[model samples]
Target: MAGEVVGHAAEAAAHGVDLIPVVALLGAAVIGVPLFKRIGLGSVLGYLAAGLLLGPSGIGLINDPESVLTTAELGVVMFLFIIGLEMEPSRLWALRKQIFGLGVLQVAVCGLLLTGMGVLLGFAPAVAFIFGMGFVLTSTAIVMQILGERGELSSESGQRIVSILLLEDLAIVPLLAVVAFLAPSSGDEVGLTARLIGIALPIGAVSLLIFLGQRIMNPFFAVLASSKLREVMTAAALLVVLGAALLFQAVGLSMAMGAFLAGVLLSTSTFRHQLEADVEPFRGILLGLFFLAVGMSLNLTTVAGSWQIIALSVVTYMAVKAAAIYAIARALKASHAEALERAVLMGQGGEFAFVLYTTAASAGIIDGPTNAVFTATVIVSMVLTPFLLIGMRRLMPKPEQSMDGIETVAELHERILVIGFGRFGQIATQTLLGQGHRLSIIDNDTDMIRAAAQFGFKVYYGDGTRLDILRAAGAANVDLVLICVNDKAAATTIAHLFRDEFPLVKVMARAFDRVHAIELIKAGVDYQLREMFESALMFGAQAIRELGATEDEVEQTIEGVRDRDAQRFKLQLMDDLSAVDAARSLLLKNAAEQAREGGVDIEEEAVEEEVAKSTQPVPPA
Candidate 1:
């Protein structure tokens, strides 16, 4: 009776709860990401580990990976969307040769070489052709993240890597068509007209998005903002992405490509920054889940059974691709170190390789066993990328690329260290740069960093709260560090962190409000300016002078206000708010009394006449 009851109860629970995949994925991410990060590996490896552990090869936790893949695919779509937002249309145009010219050369040269090898290994010409196209792709997500992390995304090698990746992304739909043509399929399903329609969908979508994006997004965001709820804003941002995705899928175009077009369209809008902030958290979580799903698809049993063949394939894949990329880089006149470093970064087979394999398998163009082998090779190549990058850094000699390389953060030597390249940080940076002071800007927002780079500011990618990031940005060596992020907690954390680590480097912080200012002051920040404090003070000065005070009196009043605020900040604001408040009250009273005694007074009627005259603009000399 007891055994029967337990079995029944288990069944009921299983039927009641249907979130095994979500729970399992979250569990893996929670367990894996931090551990990998702790051990010096990246979040990508963490996601991979989560997938491997939950996959059939490990515990068989995710028995139905296909369903997970359906969701995980959204990750790539979001990734592309963000990438589109990072580069403007005009900026993308500037790299036309890199995107079209060199891109075609690299793919044709690499694909043909790999195809030759595949044919030699006994694959049919058609099979060899598929392998050539698939293996020609490099891991865009991994390589681009690594490049951005190392602050090399705007460098020479970085530019080359991006151009190729951009071309590969654009090629996916067309390549799928080629694969369809090669496959022995019914004309009804994969006919010439159907292919043309598919091709037309993406082109038409791009044009439509370019035309309609700003008009819809700006007003849409304005309405969302008027609601004054962040959640509403986030939902609308997601609506733009998913709505675009659905539109593209309806027309038989790539969902990812459609979302990317949507993002690019929104990039030109005033709501770009707000939209990025809203979608960013979801994008990150989903992208990692995507990598996790890919990891889970790797069947360890298959890998072990054909270990020898798989190993050889992996080696050949990396070697052949690296050779091709290195040759191309050298032909482009890249220095030896830059060429070799880029080659290692580009050698890994792409995420799209596995995607194409699955697509082919579903279309019956490739058998299950063969697809399994291809999948293993692509995954292993991706897994080896981080280690390969690390090895390259260790082995390759540094290059004489720039005056300071700007390739790595450690080499970033500037007098002014500005943290957070958002709107606030940009104001500080633009001012400092305009004054001819050398500056090193750091921000985790790659989009902001990329945009700033277009205008000649090289911003490093790293979180300001991290000590290592600060050290890498040369905080200790710099004379002043500016904390200009909008997040109050983050601003406070950075201020305290710098005080502990680089106390000698004076910090000037931008506070969100009075409460935030108090927190920053407690963090040992030498100077804290509330974001609107000066503007408010200036407006108050104008109001005071118009209320009958002379210009000299107005100036003195503003000076006293600043002095009083500084005195309040100097107090122990956190532990003794009562004392600080008392001091503030006393200061205000004494200053008011002093002002009443010292300032010149005017009759009320005379003040109104004088104010009307002062409101007029000064005549030009």
Candidate 2:
């Protein structure tokens, strides 16, 4: 009895020990993330700080960071999966040029430069190459997280950066193979069969993954979805992600790469959005943990013991890598601002460095002390990246775009001022021009202005949302202001500004949709027209005429639509009955009815859909 009680107590103690690390990690993340974000250091830094505080170097809440890191790496895998879901195969194909062209160039140039720097720092040639190549693979999690936070992930420049990162991810495979080849030959050198297997295995794993993604995944998801269990769906998502990651890892390929390919395959799946939603929570938590693990993995003892070497290495490596990246970007026609941003983001060695260093150490290519110093240097560099970006933002000058032939908004006496020169503005300008109304045109797009100049349109470069630009464009002197910009928010702001500052000028604005129309009305614009309303009405009228309706019938039908829209608009403005709300309620009713029916007739669903669409407010054009 005594022995059993003692055994039970020991078991309980073990369980408690397991629970404590989880609690500490969560507590640190909860505290660190918010504090860092509030202070403007960013969540990544917050996680790092929290991790460091809990690591062996600090209070020692968690002694083994490597164990945490192994699990936390799943966060990176899921992140890549989510990114893959966003990148449709077609869209990814569209970026093939940038991916292969710019990606290859950046990697080759940065690798060579970093390798040369390593050599200059007195490392042996083979060791220097490993150091350089390891650093060459930038932290995808860090870059992607920052871009996502800034909402630039879908931008053209962002896509270009993503392409470079993709190439870097692919480069890891060959880099690992290089590490193996560079390792000092033991008495028993690797056999030819082993070398061939090493090469063939990764390729086979990738091919198997492709086949599973194309042929099995969607159907597998479909089967799981039919079960109609939310937990089961979530489990399936995890299974797919983990399974793919495991397959690649087993074959010595990148787990993140495997997950990414799986995501790309599922990008066109009907379950794409559902998969994203299911994985998002896990992705966010794990990714944070991953960063925390990275922070904990930082060997402060190692850093402290070899402070000079680590510090010098961090500074020298980061500088050389950043310079190389910046030069490559500039060579690829990136603007100064873009090149600088890329440089700041990609300056540090990533989590992959640890993997490379470990492999090299295991292979006896690098000594333990060298591995420790290099690892410490990488961690220091990662920690400094956020600070470097902050400094760059503060100190970097705003790039001055060439305006050799472009004209700025000047004081003009024209009767009308058109703020935007987009398709809508250009078409509107034609009507006023036909009526012989003198007007001044302004647009924020430099390329558009240049394009317009080719066709003899005197469009000036000016931001419509800026008060100074509006004033310079003679908004106060103009009889009317045309806010024909595509952005709903910008149009509303311009309208509100004119109503307050240029009360004498009648503000006529283009609405993005029904909601925008209401917003413009609240802004007290003298005239507001939904950009697509008139055109859509005309299109429908033409369809009616083609369906054998007489000319008068088509005209009368269009007039009825116009009148009903006006009535709805007025009602929406007065907060009486919202057309949008009414339409939403109708949709909910239809959905509920369909659910109750357990599969409504196809014809009925179509009819209900048409009804919903007709009354449904069109989204922003």
Candidate 3:
């Protein structure tokens, strides 16, 4: 038994952080994350559960989990790096107010309140001071994961959350250093100066890095690409991260900050996509490992022994922190529900607290027993956070599940109306929308309307046959009313209505056949188009070319057929059903004669297709 204990201690020691713990951890994550995910508990909770199972409260797989926790800071760097890759400089500038203003207020208010709580709980003022600062942090990994899972990262509140987290990440260095600087015996002048200088260089290392990268990095990568060795580029990418990390660490900054700056520099680079593809796998695995380390580091034995103290501390800390965040968010004009979510989402002790606690313990700012309690409090808050998130889900407004592909017209500052969002209407709407036209699209399908809402399309559910629907869609203000109703009679009604009610609007209607086109002309639509007319013309032209007609011959034959059919279509519009039949007969005879004159023998079907392509409300002239 003595030998076993000694052997285990040796394995857990600084020189030999055993591989068994790593293997056990990976295995547990492999098994646990999916199980938790299946039950909708989320993957972060699964990692924590695995940790609890392997932690001191259960089987002691790793006696000293804090060591692994310390090593897992790399995962934080990777996480920040990936975040940086997603952000452009303009976006960062846009978030500056959130990062500096709201983030600063959150830290100040929460830290002060937490510090007061610690003091009331009988901690020394200095210890309470650092405690407040450290505990003000919430778990970035967990919060970001939750926000991402719910697709709230792009939401207004979620953007603020990200900005606040960035500020906290930046605050760690100064927060850690400040309390230490206050200690009477501390001789940290050089260290303090180095950190200060690091933060405020003339060009700022971040700017310098970006400037240098824009000039040299592009050409460097280009040269590397010429070698045609992908492995080399990947290696160079890793090296870039490493170099940035070293530079920042030398200046007393977070290594994650360095990685983020490096990522931002590469964000707009031509190789950004490839770099992300390469870095994503590493970021994902390392981030998972980081969370797993947090779980393992939970000293649940201490929590059980001091359950009363642990529970009191967590409750007090979360209450104070949440109250502060909620009040601040509300002041910032976040809605009641939004403020509540931000509060609950951020009501945990951050991963940085462990570093702070460990550092304070080493500096004798906080004793061992106090540090243990505080650490447990931090972990307990984190463990409960998944539950908090689950609860918040009940209040958060459900997002749309599909996209209907309709955009509102007035929003785009241009006016176009699309009636009948069927297959034909949808195609026309999509094309017009692509050209920067603002289109108000109305469809009869409620399911399509709801589904489109998910994709952020604002489509109205209404029948095109209703004048009320047309007025609501602002047909009067529209420059063009694209009528693509699949029904021939319904389409004719809409064309006439637009021509009568909104005469200034361009009325273009899709026709089912030549008969529909003539009816649309009689109804006074400005233009009439057969849906498949151009398609048939192209097909017939291709057939003519394949059948040994030269390009000029095919062009001339198609044009001749178009002219003759246009004349026939005019006759149909001028007369009645009998006149249309007579016009078709004359058109076929003329096309066959023309095809012979051009030495391109035209089939009856080919002549008919050309005639269909040739018909217009009025001849081209």
Candidate 2 lDDT over 1-621, as tens digits, reads 967865676588787664667878999999889999998899899999999999999888688999999999889999999999999999999999988998888889888988898899899988888888888888898989999999999999899889989888888888888888888877787779988998799889989988998899899989998998999999999998999999999999899999999999999999999999999999999999999999998988898899987888889889988998898888878888999899999999888888888998998999999998988888888889999988888898866766878999888779999999999999988989999998899988888889999998999999888899889988888898899999998998898889789988888899989988878876778778888888999899889888999998998888999899888776666563355457676876777678668965456566567666655543321
- As a TM-score, model 1 comes out at 0.64
Greater lDDT among 2 and 3 belongs to 2
In model 2, what lDDT does residue 313 have? 80
Can you write out model 1's per-residue Cα lDDT over 454-484, one digit (the tens) per residue?
8877778778888888888888799999999
Q: Which ten residues in a row have the lowest lDDT in candidate 3?
A: 405-414
Instruction: Give the range of the ten consecutive residues with the poorest summed lDDT in model 1.
Output: 612-621
Evaluate all candidate structures by whole-model CA lDDT and list the values in order: 0.78, 0.87, 0.79
Task: Pull out the clashing pairs in model 3.
Answer: 402-451, 402-454, 402-455, 403-452, 403-455, 404-452
Each prediction's number of clashing residue pairs = 0, 0, 6
Writing each residue's lDDT as its tens digit, candidate 3 over 577-618 gives: 446656876777786988789998777787777666555334
TM-score of each: 0.64, 0.70, 0.64
- In the predicted model 1, the residue pairs found to clash are none
Question: How high a TM-score does candidate 3 get?
Answer: 0.64
Best by TM-score: 2
Question: Which candidate achieves the best lDDT against the true structure?
Answer: 2
Q: Scored by Cα lDDT, where does model 2 land?
A: 0.87
Lowest lDDT 10-mer window, candidate 2?
612-621
Off by over 4 Å in 2: 1-17, 399-472, 475-621
